[model samples]
Target: MTIQRHVPATDAADRAMLEGWLDYHRQTLAQKCEGLTDEQLRTASVPPSDLSLMGLVRHMADVERGWYRRVLAGEDAEPLHYDEADPDGDFHLTGTETWQEAYTTWQAEMDVARRNAAGFGLDDLARGRHRSGERFTLRWIHTHMIEEYARHNGHADLLRERLDGATGD
Candidate 1:
């Protein structure tokens, strides 16, 4: 799969730099999923772990909604595909959810995230109660999102390798 790689700006404002990195990481995840089939995407990374390419997509969609819609935009975001009842539903396809749905949902959330973020500056304050009951800022959310994607992209790398022996930056 040919993943579309975007060159992040070398010299830019703080916001641009952060956004560029975040966008870069986003594309990286998509690149990892580029050539995978439904079965391949649904393939778990390791035993006792439900992590997969499609699962990552679903989980990231949830993440995008949580941060961009709920936290950033304060849009009273409801659960996208998971809840307290089944926290891991994002990763559990169970043959009910198709790979296409995951991709479309992920892209849709990405769109919302981008739109929601457009109005805020880096230092813009958005009150959000984390799962741990901690307040957060839009800046923190941006940095957290980058780290989240980087961590998951690492897992994606391993998963892709397991799936098709693919590897590299």
Candidate 2:
């Protein structure tokens, strides 16, 4: 499927702008993984680092769930790919999940994130605390999510270019 990334409007309200950019980055990540076989999606960037396109998708899914469901909505959501014993489990795939599965899961998490944030204003506090024991406002979460995707999307660009010479913003 083709991923459509809309550029965020420069003159929009804070929440609209944040959501637009976040979605753009999300679609950017999806576009980076398009047209690759499962093995190619799972291919590591380097010998030591287990980072791959599939791993990024899995990681983002967990990130969305953590921030939106666990924090914002106060839902008892569990991590899909990690635990205390294996904190980075999402990035270290067991070779059983297909690319479609990972993509579907990520999209589902995104849907939940949108729903969870719909009723909250920018200054509203989250229901949960960060690892540092600090509570976050909706604005902070939105900004942090954009930064998270932006950084990971950069890694995705490098990985994609390395895999198939495909690169773009």
Candidate with the greatest TM-score versus the true structure: 2
Assess candidate 1 and give its lDDT.
0.87
Instruction: Give Cα-based local distance difference scores for all models.
Output: 0.87, 0.93
RMSD of each: 1.5, 0.9
Q: What stretches of model 1 exceed 4 Å from their correct place?
A: 131-133
Give the candidate number with the greatest lDDT: 2
Query: Least accurate stretch of 10 residues (summed lDDT) in model 2?
Result: 127-136
In model 1, the clashing pairs are none
lDDT of 2 at 93: 79
- Per-model TM against the reference: 0.93, 0.97
lDDT measured at residue 81 in model 2 versus the true structure, 0 to 100:
95
Question: Can you list the residue pairs that collide in candidate 2?
Answer: none
lDDT of 1 by residue, 77-160 (tens): 887878899998888878667778988888899999998888887777765566676657778999999999999999999999
